[model samples]
Target: MDDPYKLHATAMPLEQRRAALTALAGKIRSGGTELGWQVTWNVDYGDFTWLIGGHINNIGDPFDDNEFSSETKAVERAVLDYFAELWGIPPPHDPQDRNSYWGFLLTMGASEGNIYGLWNARDYFLGKDLLLPEHSSGDGVEPREPVLLYSVESHYSVGKTAHVLLLETPADVGARRYPGQCPIEGEWPQGVPATGGGSGPGTIDVHALRALVEFFAARHHPVIVVLNAGTTFKGACDDIAAVNEILAECYSATTGPSWQTRPGNGGRPDRRSWYWIHVDGALGAAYLPFFAMAPERADLESGIPVPAFDFAVPGVCSMVVSAHKWIGSPWPGGVYLTRNRYRMRPPPFPEYVGSADTMLAGSRNGQTAVVMWDFLARNSYETQTTEAVTALRLARYTEAKLTALQHNSDHVPDLWVGRSPWSLSIRFRRPAQDIVDEFGLSGMRVQVQGADRAYVHLYIMRDTPRDRIDALIRRLAEPGAF
Candidate 1:
């Protein structure tokens, strides 16, 4: 019996709507029991929820002129300022000037950020030094094609981004070196491309990367490097400092017709930077800074012993971090930060919203910025530092617990655990299907040493307490309890 109230246009009764929402809320709350995923589900956005009621559209650039919609663009500015300060990016001296550090909240998670960052890099390199001018017959100028390099473990969005932007991806270039395998010089099916995938998770083989950079440099092509700060699978972090050093070497190296150069020779050593490094710190960028800034972690000297994959890295021209992942925002949101010099690659123009169209998205999520701002405002730096320390400690505890279980068990013979020193993702042997489903674990079958192995990943979030981890460990240790 189809009730007239259930038809379209005629809205459901207030009571029915309330009841439906209440039921959904309960189911969602129940799902929050197992905190094995990356996001913190228990986050209360608090007073910022009020902003959702209004039709707020943060169109155009936040840093540019705005006179139309009365959205909370100012809060967005504060959020960017906080991140800029944290990442060592200096803001423009003048408020109206768009020639320094520029950043904005993005709508489509870190994927959007990745696209924006790569787009910026592509435009920057192409527009900097003209290689060839366009023909008078209406053909566009052919700039030196920029090569893109990223680890195999980089977010799948990176590959998609390359496709969307019409850039040559690694797969397109045919650089397919599996982990622990190197490409044979003469045996390559086609000409060797840029960098090969790293042997470790979320890392780029610096040796291979150098080779790739050199290969492109020989042809005078610009290189763009994407270093993973925290990867999706095994949570491996590429050595940003090492990569920076390699790029610096390539940037300053001298090459001439005879491979010999003197002061008066035409080979001025390509004084312009030949490479750009963009840190994909989507998972770690939000919290790692807190760990690095904590008082207890100060004695550790650089906290994680890595110089960090933030703006602090000299070669890092841009970075993208997810606010939804570590910062506990309700919706999928992220921040993309780049040098002001690189941001204006797309010439500024008057947008319909009265501001310049500088951002990746046309009509951006206004509420996302408000939520992020509210979260950041509520959580102080010291509190965030404590939270970061706690997350790392929990990861260590999880790893130790799994190791202990492996030590005591005979069934799980080759229990391989993979995790970076400063990451929250703990990768280990996959358990029974039921247990995995109960805990909401992310499982995948991966190849290790030419053997297929089933692995499950657990992400330690802020709300994941010690007791929750203990419960999971107990179940895992139980005989025949897989």
Candidate 2:
């Protein structure tokens, strides 16, 4: 048979195309149980099939009405409002109100949101009047150069954003391309190092972070810190509240040249300090609130502690969450939420798009908003909280099962089964290649007791249940499976 995945200049027969698509769908369905990534496969988008064929683009800000009538801005706004309520922010009453929440749908997942947040932070620290560029000419006290700081466990997007924005780092200062770009005049890691000695496996040490911030603040440099609500590999969350406390202390102690103390453009207020706190909550942000709301629920009594990472925390300026991770979207998409006061006043409205281009992407995916709205509408708060608790329970079950298997004398030895508190992922000894491929497991190598050991993790998403975990255990029990 000809390869169904191959494409040619000549069009295939209609019957052949149908058969090829059917075969591909069958393969996906057959392997659905083995999907180990963060993506949730228990979603049904049958009701949205009709809207898929239309070219509905959400052009600009969700709250602002644009001339593009074919967009789904209303639905997008509803989605943002839902998240605002979840993340403890007041919904926007008016588009121009600075106190209300402001945000937009992202077409390119959390990476786009991360980039957007970092860009806003960089510009905000630079004191550039984005709304009126003409009035920003050498105004007020010269703003201190901003330095980028993030945990070593942060998503690769944070570092990539720093490189793209040309933001200074301790390691990149004396390099070949841009010399002396970093203002910090001492040794520092490119990324803030994570905590060691098993206090918090993948979380950043707040003390170390405070020391670093003090070092930078003393040198008259503004700071931008990216906190992770859920790390990629270990699924650990940083203590955002503690970090906020550190920022408050630093703010009180530091006496530096003020950046936004004088109104340069748009009559902005007198802000004494320059700092930005962004949370990359691609996984945890989507469900942690639900966990917090229903901590006493029967199934969620696993003793896993939930950390706060939302607008309620005073220092958090911006946050992003992936729809595909916990909310189960078909494609990579998300929502970026921040207060309207913190939003960078967008450049003059573009007449071509017929709306103010406040978001990162001009032509956003309208169908994504519909899909997210559908999911949220179909699932109530109670339903979502139950589902979140179920996922956590399954993760605990997997960890317990794997630990049992490790202790079994006839089965694998030195399994190194481990899981973090409130994490939906379990890490253990790497199984054979066939098992890894069949289960869609992700592998990593780390130093264990001073010896390098191979590890693989399984994420307990919405669709992953005990039966699937049992099947994985059965495969590992086979002779020489590891």
Top candidate, metric lDDT: 2
Candidate 1 local Cα displacement, residue 236, angstroms: 2.2
Task: Report lDDT (CA) for all predictions.
Answer: 0.70, 0.79
Instruction: Indicate the worst ten consecutive residues by lDDT in candidate 1.
Output: 256-265
Task: Provide the TM-score for each candidate, comma-separated.
Answer: 0.84, 0.90
Clash number for every model?
Answer: 0, 0
Instruction: Please give the lDDT score at residue 223 for candidate 2.
Output: 82
TM-score of 2: 0.90
Compose the digit string of candidate 2's lDDT tens values, residues 1-482.
Answer: 75776878999888889998999889876655654588888778888887777789888777778777888998998999999988988775455665578788888999999999999888777665544232322344445678888998899999999999999865653253335543333454798878872323778878778877776666566788999888888888899999988876775577433444334345654453457799999999998888887858534644545788999998888999998888888788998988766666787888887788788878889888998999898899899889888888888888888888878857577787877767887888889999999889998887755777888888988778688899998888888897
Worst 10 residues of 2 by lDDT: 130-139
1-482 per-residue lDDT for model 1 (tens digits): 65433546877888877877787778777866665567877786566656777788888888764776567688888888888888887664243343357788889888898998898777656554211211122222222567888876788888788788887643444444232222334232222222332224546667767776665555556678888888777666788888888777764573321121112113222122456788888888888778777777754323457447887777888898887788877778888887654443344576556887777777888887878887787789989999988888788888888888888887655457766667789888888877788788898777665677888889998888788889888888777765
Model 2 regions lying over 4 Å from their true place: 1-8, 13-20, 130-142, 173-187, 197-200, 256-272, 295-304
- Per-residue error for 39 in candidate 1, Å, reads 0.6
Clashes of 1: 0
